[model samples]
Target chain A: MAGHSAGTEIERLIQLLSRLPGLGPRSARRAALQLLGKKETLMRPLADALQDAADHVLTCTTCGNLDTTDPCSICADGRRDKGVICVVEQVADLWALERAGANSGQYHVLGGTLSALDGVGPDDLNISGLVTRVSGSDVREVVLALNATVDGQATAHYITDQLEGSGANVSQVAHGVPVGGELDYLDDGTLAAAMKARRPF
Target chain B: MAGHSAGTEIERLIQLLSRLPGLGPRSARRAALQLLGKKETLMRPLADALQDAADHVLTCTTCGNLDTTDPCSICADGRRDKGVICVVEQVADLWALERAGANSGQYHVLGGTLSALDGVGPDDLNISGLVTRVSGSDVREVVLALNATVDGQATAHYITDQLEGSGANVSQVAHGVPVGGELDYLDDGTLAAAMKARRPF
Candidate 1:
């Protein structure tokens, strides 16, 4: 398939594009053609953007977030509550929380959840950094904004144990029916959790 | 959503990626993070590929196919049958045909189909170039391998009209129930076309 491509450069572009999360080989070729057709408007700009991101974007030392700044914009923002830190599985989760305006606190990206089959441990993650942040600072609460998966729960529990003596209170986000989520379509576990964690109107 | 991003470079990358055919804003962000996470392996190579494509790729002067060479690889290929030319609406279509190994002939990309609503006319397409190729070369047949859309058929008819004096056989690819397609799931128009164009059992 690659050999039949118009040019090696274009083929290489498609190959690299297919490596992206949502794109496959077929769609990658389509994307390559689209980029070729709109060279100035889409292709060049995307090229410039990718190059720029490659050159500038860095991991935030403070919160393990990807940013241009060493501490990241969230960590640098003085307006955000310094006393609260939202723990998440990845930078995307951090961005999701920010997009939702769900919290006015800082974020701590754990990179990924603890996976036993994958052999990911506390050392593999940014757990020590998170513990140091909670222990060194006057942080009042460390909120686990991790997903409701088994690995996510296990990771949260591990972090909670690590932050046991750190003065900061460890709390997990609630597991229940999502906003606008239908009860009928939801899983039995979610329905059961929602029932048990029912709040007063 | 853009404003809440960690860095401007990452934000711009996400924005550019979201403009690709299949990706939305959310997936674009996820792609950006994936790129950031695997900077050396994925991000840098993709950037290099894009820049290389931008710097090198050129449209084939003869058939409107995109390649680093002006004539394109297919047009330059001595092994391919120059006697037949497959006409397609876009370079992607040409790639698809090549991927399928559907033909051993040369190709002529039309860039896009004729669209009255979009104000796409003959002047906007490579119809004249195709005519010139057929008239000048020993081309025996010009195959219209366009989509089944109304715009595609309109473009094919328009091209057929323009090739009146070119002395080349103008034929369109057959439209029928696709291979492995079930009659129960096939649309009415496709079923009707399949029935009308029934071949020897």
Candidate 2:
């Protein structure tokens, strides 16, 4: 049906584009048409780029960050604090922390969190790999920078429990009202926590 | 900065995905991550699909519809009303009309409508090709199924002016409250048009 007016090739392209995160059927069709319109400037280059990424991109063997290298540029960089490992639920969270300039330490991507309701558990995550990395490295601290969500916190707790007496200090990121966030917009729990940890500012 | 963690290849891929019609930078990154997660099942196939589309999709020489062939399926189909050419601004429009079963005629895609502010003119569109198609063919009617937008009306007027002496009758699609649309929710213009063109049920 999709190929009735446009070709089968365009239909297939739209199908693939719809599989992408933000695009639906209409947007995918629009995108396909746009690409066809700008084939020389966009469509051919997009195909080449996707092929390049599929062929070259690899997950870091040490931290699980997606990159072009085995260990990744982050893991390969000796300047980072390798003795401190920052644990994150996903590569996006790790990137968020890195973007905020909050941590100069290496990261461990958990891929996902512990969610009992969703049938996810310790074995479902990268917890065993985290333990392996800690047991093999001279890490001074294992920082859990997971999300504030229940699953993220539960995963952090589970990781912390696993690393008990592993000859390294285990810690997690703080919880407080976000910077530039209005107090009225803050939830009761956040307000309570912010009050409990009130600063001199 | 995008290459800081995900590598230059991924950064470049995100850059191209963001160039798509509906995807922004953040969504593009998410899409890239999703593609990477399913490289074998999705990413590789998507790359091949895009390549195939870019390589094979061509505009129909007869109707300007995009297809795998020069004349396109609609133009070549012996069952369709080839004597009645339905003119639309884009292939999407052609498909929309086809989806609604509104027309079973050959199509002419203008690619885009005339917009003086946007620097688009009659010469910039497929007007001359349309003239040639009508002049050299047995076409009896030209249905302007263009959108009711300002530019769409302007373009329709231009095409009508050019086809003045042509034997083929020119007709714009009727305007009214859309089928299954409530009268209260309809725009004033649509209500008036519907009232003026009212018929016994």
Candidate 3:
């Protein structure tokens, strides 16, 4: 495998594919083989798609969403509720929320959380843009849909502090036992949060 | 996600990535986000590598191995023992054997096994080319390093029959307990095979 018996081009393809988030070396090799086996059907189209994305996909100036347009489809759409903006850590989280259909409002991507260990500060993220979007606008509610991680909470708190008197009500997505999640398999923190947040049903 | 919130190019990239062997829709989205995040470093290089592979990689005429050249580096090399030909089902198997340093001899890729149910026949494989290479040559042995599956063995038997009286000894890789296999977790058929093929050590 090191000597690349399949040739340099195939080896390079496998190496690049292995760098993807979920693909390992073995699966990358298999993927390369499949691509080579069906060049016209899979490989060519995939190459074209990658090229197209690289050339066209851009970050939205308003929401920080990745799209072919500057404002993105979500920002450009008139049907979405502009008054309530769901703030997420990344475009992936926004896509997840959209897929789940949990929000009918607009979205604001922060790019990433404030990570001190990695030397990632507020300036490294799109926090300033979010504050600017929230201030002097029709946006009445800003929902923090960030992850439950420490950095995510810290970033949310920082954003909340930044939007203190912007005349927009700040809120956070509920943190409790996930729907359909087994309590036996849940962590102590989640169990405590679920207990504390219990409502009168 | 269905409406291509990230735009058509990003959605197309994710769709193509999901079609790969090991990636599903969720992982594809993650991979696409990673690519978008690192457009210059990862996405562009991957696109270039894939395009290069699609344009240059050709099927080796001698052994059916994928390579940039016709005869392939293996066939072109003068140091390899041409007298012993290791036959495998596909280029992947040939690569596996090469990676393990299992064979110093030449190779013959059969493309695929003889699958009657799938309507694959002898003519569909590169069996005739292997026979032609073995006949009227100084070849001493033809090793069938095919899978231990039913179709693989059937193809091996058919090849053994076809290569009869061709001045070459036909053999198959042994099937038994793997080198690092545990006895307790061994299957009945494997344990039986190991017992039947016991050596006087």
In model 2, what lDDT does residue A197 have? 82
Question: Positional deviation of B124 in candidate 3, in angstroms?
Answer: 2.2
Q: DockQ of candidates 1 onward, in order?
A: 0.72, 0.75, 0.75
The runs of at least 3 residues in candidate 1 whose Cα sits more than 4 Å from the true structure, single-residue gaps closed, are: A2-5
Pairs of colliding residues, candidate 3: none
Model 1: per-residue lDDT, tens digit, B1-201?
A: 455647888888988999998899988988888888888899888888888898899988988888899788888899999999999988888888888899899999888989999999899988888998899679999999999999999999999999998889999999998999899999999999999999999
**What CAPRI class is candidate 2?**
medium
> What is the alpha-carbon lDDT of model 2 when measured against the actual structure?
0.88
Query: What would the per-residue lDDT of candidate 1 be over residues A114-190, giving only the tens digit for each residue?
Result: 99999999999999999889897899999999999999999999999999989999988999999999999999999
lDDT-based ranking, best first? 3, 1, 2
> What TM-score would you give candidate 1 relative to the actual structure?
0.95
Candidate 2 regions with alpha-carbon error over 4 angstroms: A1-3, B1-3
**Number of the top candidate by lDDT?**
3
Docking class of 3: medium
- Native interface contacts retained, candidate 1: 0.78
- How much does candidate 3 score in TM-score? 0.96
Error of 2 at A92 (Å): 1.4
